[model samples]
Target: MKKKLLTVAIGSAVALTIAGCNSSSNSTDTDTNKLLPKDATIAFAGVKAPVTDAEKRAILASDATITTGSDSMPLDLEYNVFARSGDTFDHAVFGQLVDKQGNPLSKEDGSPSIANSNEFTSLLPRGERLFSVSQFESRPGAMFLMELNQNTENGELSVKDAWQIDQSGVNGGWVHCAGSVTPWSTHLASEEYEPNARSLVTGADAAADRYAAGFLDYFNGDESQWNPYQVGWNIEVDVQADSGAAPTATSKKHYAMGRLAFELSYVMPDEKTVYMTDDGTNVGLYMFVADKAGDLSAGTLYAMKWNQTASTGVGAADLDWIDLGHATSAELSDYIEGANQLAFTDIFATADANEDNSCPDGFTSINAGGNGQECLQVKPGMEKAASRMETRRYAAMMGATTELRKEEGITFDPTRSKLYLAMSEVARGFESFKKNGADSSSYDLGGPNHIQLEGFNRCGAVYQLDVASDATIGSSYVAKNMSALVAGVPATDSYGDGVQNPIVANSADYADNNKCHIDGISNPDNVTYMSGWDILIIGEDTGSGHQNDVIWAYDFGTQALTRIQTTPYGSETTSPYWYPNINGWGYLTSVVQHPYGESDSDKDTGNGENRAYTGYVGPFPAKAE
Candidate 1:
């Protein structure tokens, strides 16, 4: 396949002619016909530095020249803000909380309660029509469906109808963070930062208390029916849309995947293997291999063990897996609905450790899921239930590494048989493991210290994992090796003296705004890999690493990082996904979430409107063979 350059101008509304681009070297002719050429490069020009204008810094803005290659083709890369937090479409208000019958819930002021933190979105095409499912990242989370109308001739998209998906059937979602579309065309969403069951039950956690308040509000103040086990599993939603009627969505929680604070779940090409990332401190990386292809109802769960080879530059490791047992979703669901309800005490017994951090004779001391060191003993005859329901604790009990910090988004590169995972920050247990080593009692308590690093990098890093066949797991896409593909560069002061920030006050200089190198990524949260193009799109969710979160495009061929977009101050760049071809039109979806909600909470404009945005970067022409 031959390649051509495509130039896109912002705010111009110009259109470009379709041209043949490079095809993937390993891709088949049929696959090549469906995607862009492998040699074709998507590059961004201009903007050598971060945004400095105060007005521009307060809004979502982009000033980059998007081009394909050397040849010139006129295309307009437009920014579309189609949906906001409180906007209404098709008689349904976005981000609005709803009841069991799908009616909108009201706030104390009698206004419709809305979710401000919107995260992942999946665009699914059905015949000539398109539908999108978006998740809200809040306590007692929510999800909605939108019918998108695309002008095939002009490559423009618009939402025609929208409504909230009913979640009462599987209990309400909690902190739906990020998601992906399955090969079978279902939306796979996540429930992040699962409330600590023991803490919630004992009223010992203030944060859990706050979460329970919001969750109780969702149930119309029904405190007796609250259940913490119902919200942490991966949820799969199947949408069926016909020609003229509203789409119907059916959802199920896959309890077989084990309970964790899931950031997202990425399924491998084989369909039986899945990689799931846990999102907080002292978290563990997990994998689930389904008993049958294309089904997640029953699977074997495994935790990662990082055997370190080098302790420099984000480190390197040979990966091993620890089988954590398995069960069907039905079995776990039965436990949730049964008379016992599987409370924290039913599966394990806990006790306070001595001042020296030593556990009793029968209890094991372990740290997992940012809960700090805990002394616990698994009850007899409840190991299977504990493995699936109290996953992090059980994994730690089985001697798996649980020192990962802020593990975020995941994407696969089938051509290279590789997987990319984002670690939002390289601190907390990650730094402690390096300083204390595996033998130290201060870190990794009861688990092994598989990862060791040289220094702390609060700016974070992106890791690449090699996938291969594992006979024991009976999957062809098991992750075998892990290493850092790219890491953020921590910045020093103007005098090159202090590693930490020297400028504490707000300054007019642009260089003082960020603690990490402005040219590299910081606190990368969501990542998407464009297969044929060899481009990785990285988004940031940072409060102090960078002043304004950015969306970056990294080209593997040239190893160049380009700043494609920047969100408002205190906002996050989320859901950077690429849909290669959707009815002869392509899109790169991007969402700017919670403007001025993070770092600049007190610096509101006072216009009475602060809503999150959901939109995309382009409608690139989809070429056929």
Candidate 2:
């Protein structure tokens, strides 16, 4: 196998960057600016024309039924090494919840694993030696793990022998989004959201904290067991070789890292610093710097505040981190107790903590209490209980910028000291300031998260931020959005023909007017960069514009975006991960999330199609040495 070198245009001269480059330290030297070929051109589009029998069979087995279509491993990709070295040789991909006896594990309700019928799920593969596939079970949510069996002669990769490593009731899981495989070989799965269930707890003295009632109800209204401490935080699993078995693998819920509608965890090369995002209307970006490397049990969480410099949503803006303070799991538990015992007002003050005078009239904060660290004061009337438990609210209280809609996947470019995040959609006239909404100023930043302008693509977008290299520990670090890209086809006269951004009004009009413009992959969801190659893979979770979600690979240097694969209509292309030189293959793996509906069952449809598939495609062109 030869190492392939890519020549990119750099200051009137070509710079070479190797593809599939992995170092001995398990880190990569993937430089986006030097990875694209100098003459790289955008690939032209063509019809999806039906797939071959072999291709279709690889995705839809003889047992699967009740599906209109399936797309796995298109021509541009191949199976990763993780898929090849599996125990079975059927070359067949598997879904969640298969037992040791080669059967779909059933719940106490006598049903299969609670599959997210209509939600987004992220899939990530990790390992130091053997492969461990981690999937977010969005519904009745939980993270599922499976280890691939070593491949044997004539045996293709199959789940027939795969084991379900995590039990459903174990480690309290909820709806999750894109996650990360850490440098320390740990699986960090994020919990997307769970509505504040505290209001449901019926008690004479139930507290006003958002999660208070939910925790009480979880314990059957027993306030003594208010473990609202669980859920919504990042859960780290030990996926080591010997620890891959079920009931034995240890897990930790990272409480110090504030909880919110977590989207993804981006652990930096240093292994101590991490970047994470909140997914919802008016959210904030966060970073967690652990006390030490390889351990995330304790850390300082900071929220990002963006200073709007221009009307266009894109371009660089001044960024600063607000120290939100730190707390251990035990400290959070004690705070929850104090918040419940005392009146919420006594614990949280309505006046401004910082006398800088820029604090709004309605904002709230608690006394600094001389914590010895410069902490950012939160919103007016926000309780400390809410800050640690209901993190988004605390972030807003600290004067951290909010109103980030559906902040999703996050990935880092260590070589460039940059981080890219996905804002799934930026509705017209969107504003991060949620309070006193009518009076709040709405500024449109450029990129996929803003309204579509003429000749500008309107869908979702990605933002690039420059992270300071020598950011001091426990001090505010500065970062800025250097650029943003709103996605959609340039407003062309042909838009009316449904060749680009199509209009369907609603689901009822989908069939007749279903032709969607897929030229530009819209409503991007999961994003990951293949180091050395500098290829960024953007996965879509959209059911509009293009009902069939697609995955696109954007060459950073060449600026060429190519659609690599498209999922069945109504199905989301979630968690498209790219890895360099996996089993000698540059592989990409994705999950076709709930393609059709639950009605599409495992009946004999004669066509042998299913609504779901975990696609494995790879061994793509490795760098030639």
Candidate 3:
């Protein structure tokens, strides 16, 4: 049998093209037909990890049995599956394969543990192979064989099986996290980031920006094209289930989808609007206004920012209609020289806390054509930091030379009008050294400081966001009005049914974190808990790289955060976090919800579309008796 390749949490991404378009104008199409919401936003970043029972309930409760196309379909089985490429996240290979006993398979040494009795056929769905001990056998219940929606001619990894469902395209890559069948009979697949970029980008525009220097590097400059240039986008996959090919790439680029890693997507019962999330951690949060609402083609983009309580400020607003509206390649290079200087300057400051070199030599604003750090950018060398410079030096440590967000996992509740966000576990402390301890001396980042002030929020947590069902809050969540509902406090148990906090060195106070679970809330209006408008899902990784596969829930109305009933991290290759951590591959890629039985998500049935279905990013927690 062939080895199984684990997928990244935030694997692929795509770009939207909805510029000046009003999907409402689709009067030409049948009145029953409507485009998806282009103006969406994700308000989940820098939020604390969940710790209470309520937070855990949100994730488990999301699986309620309501409506279903087939009574025989299993809708409430608490399912989790692995994600593959969607043309956006181009990891080595993606997806999860486990055994019937729920035991995880291994992907060690660049190879998976496949017993001689297992099957190993390349073309999925068609060529059959009986397996005795393969990733497939590790699954709990009956397994569904899904494949990348690309043509066989495209690459070696093509779906050769006689499978059924809907979705396909040359790059008909499926957005792992978010998926929804449109009211118009199409499915919406989310593209997290630009796969072509390959490595994560620490600085947004590499063309000019470097560390945090103010001067340009005359020597060894420009030749490497060290310029931060990446062709990427957030795309929607149209599920033409009728044909084997679904989620067509022809979907328009939602201009409303500001700029960031497109994490998840959701639709409302009204069937005229959609919602999305920017899975970029500590980056931004926002919402968009679809020109015609749901027109996916064109719409106005906006972001949500929080003002101090009673400060009387505008929390949500779209960025200026600048030439390079979204994160465009053109604007990234204008001040190329200035950018490089700024980057190196910051790097130097991190090595040694010398304010003299803190402010680079030539990093003047006027030189970069009005392009500089977006105020929200994190600067090194702070007096009140919790750890050493290595804490904030993500670029140098992780190949993230440009992008700095490891954000992942996002879901939406149309009925409750909420979003559920989760992030990977924190691998290390705020310090560069892989040690975990709370010195409170190196806690200086904008978002990091805010989290420390709040008691509970520690490592590898989840958050909730209050948002409108029709608002565009996904792709542009960076500037969103973010508020931490749940604090990521550690647990009393360490080796229990919970995830581990990667930064254990700084977390001496939180040693017994076994029972510790980063959770979120849902249906906050309940008398016992708080109410959440939408749930945003995201996670943080410990410096160790051991991914903790857990989900958090939240409620917008009561302003409460709940924890989900997650079992624990699987220590095998078949486990959820294996690929992203062990293999040093995959990401918390994307979080999405599709209809039961079929991989299509429909919201018209109402926010109360109480239908049961199984969704997975890993193995299903519903262990069979």
Candidate 4:
């Protein structure tokens, strides 16, 4: 049997040279003036590591203070609420429903036309709508168009009413996760929790299929066409218009981006290239290059294949790209119409056939009855359905690395030219390097062709991948150097139930069993980079032993992390978004989901008390130069 490659958590810092920033004197600092907040009172360059839990407790106990011009405790951006729980958020965006002339539809009152729109209103409070056990239903997730009104007298800025764009999921908006603003000024809303149909249904026998059959219920309405393949594509919303008009937003699912539990998509400066992160177990990192710049409808997809020099999940390694090919939804529909389960199976069997018509080495075969078998290798004829629908399985067939566990948010930092990927937990057979105060070497070579790194721990991590400088469209690329920006200490005990019970340090004075010590950034989830300020906003979604999830700001320059805000107990801080110059002041949007937690009953049926909040933080005035 081939070894399953272990997911490594290696982090090593490199000297960074600021990119695109000009070096000029105070009088001639035009570029500097443009990048810096015009009324910047404090310099927001570096960050400080997280404070102790006791310190955090005291800090939370008191009102957050912002001392202007204070370098030690720099509070550059003042945080404020945009929308709270039960407001217009908590719903999903279907797409930017546009007419023939490409204008957004609206009613006489200027409210978006929800009727003609394709947003599925039924899938809200996702668990209730899909599980079939609950009569109560919740709303889908939504995107807000916030208006920042500048105060004429004090030069302060505040957010006006954030108008609702559109809310429906008819075109596929299930569990809207992390998002990104495209170079063309559009919002890319991603879908999470979409199951893989090929591996879950067709690949298994009736007995095995019965266990996985429930996943087909993820898509409602048309059960005939509704398979695990439909919901997980990157859903784009056109909310990037100017703030003057009641900013109308629309949505569209990019079928070419591959259907998976997407965390987010980051488009490169080149406009045509995009990096999409899959937020699930045993997933792959993908890159999509559009046929035309700024047009995402058609594109080619590729997955990453790692070449490791060491076994530790940490450190530098080379990355090879596997082209999975591409096809549109129309083409896919046609292919599926002509191909049945037996046809799809034959496609794989034909590709799996060697000269002797036997499965290849390292490939496993499972009986599908009546002498039909399925092989775990790339079948040349299976690219179409596999690429866009059964993405993870397709990548595996193409020899791409598939050991990543919960590969969450991916944000590009233009200044450092580095892309940061948050792996919620480092433990999936990866052991810690410093176990019991000594070097414990347990790095193993696992996965196909020894293409995966091995390590330990259930603590989380953020990987800094430095891709090539001149990467072009459709070109295979490698991580020039890959390092862990920050890695949480491995969990001490998980209580034998298999889930990690991270032992966090209570005080900065203490060190042992401090798995959650690095200033409480364990289980890092949604992340985004404020390029102008060089701040990486990281949010958390951790399990027990960790109280409320907090959002942190990590300064790449100082290598320090500071906890910015704490969510309600048992809530996950989500989607830390930054939009510069919203009414001349920078603005951020984040959410706290399922505040105060939820019960099994609450999840099954909608509980009015259990709600998610969409917060708007920022509008900090520019300080004197």
Give the alpha carbon lDDT tens digit for every residue of 1-625 in model 3.
1111122222222211122221222111212222212222112222233234232112321222211122221112222322321111231122232332223235446444322111111111211211000111111111223343321121111222222111111112222333334444333444443221212234234333332111112111223423222112334433222233422113433323433444444444444334444443332333343434346554433333223232111111122111112222232222222343223233333222225323233221110001112111234542111011111122112111111123344444444444444433222211222223333322232122212221122343443455432222332222222333344444432432144545443343224333343232211111111112133332222321222323343335445443332311221111111111101111121122121112112312333221221223221111101
The estimated TM-scores of all candidates read 0.89, 0.67, 0.40, 0.67
Candidate 3: lDDT of 308? 28
Residue 462 of model 4, lDDT score: 88
The local lDDT score (0 to 100) that residue 25 gets in candidate 2 is: 22
**Candidate 4, 1-625: lDDT as tens digits:** 1111101111111111222222222221123343443322223332233244322221121112223233223233333433333233223222222222224444459754332111111101111111000000111233444443444332233344444444444333355667777776666777775644444443233124543333222222124543345456777665433324344556677777777777778788778788888776556678887777788888888887766656664434567778888666556654433344223353344335455535668664322111223456546666676677666666766777665667888887876678888888654413223222235322112234332334453557888888664354353333455568887654345322233545645453333423454455678887888755667988777754245466777866677776666644345666777655432334456655555462122322234323444434444332223
Q: By descending lDDT, how would the candidates be arranged? A: 1, 4, 2, 3
Worst ten in a row by lDDT for model 3: 577-586
Better of 1 and 4 by lDDT: 1
lDDT computed for candidate 3: 0.26
CA RMSD per model (angstroms): 5.2, 11.5, 17.3, 12.2
Each model's lDDT comes to 0.76, 0.49, 0.26, 0.50
Clashing pairs in 1: 22-37, 22-38, 23-37, 23-38
Residue lDDT tens for model 2, 1-625: 1111111111011111223322222213333332223232222232231133222222211110011123221222222222211113232223333332234445568754434322232222344234554554443243434544323221123332333444333334556666777886667877776444333233433445543333232233445533333567787777544444432345676777877778878788888888888887556788888888888867777877766555443223567677787666555544434454432333343443355533345544321111111223333444445556666656655667664566788887765777778777654224332121223223222111222222222366777778776446542223555357435442223433223334433344333323333456566788888776666778777644554566777777677676666554345667776555433334466666654432223321433233355544443433322
lDDT head-to-head 1 vs 2, winner: 1
**For each predicted model, how many residue pairs clash, with residues at least 3 apart or on different chains?**
4, 50, 212, 40
Instruction: Give the C-alpha miss distance for residue 334 in model 4, angstroms.
Output: 4.4
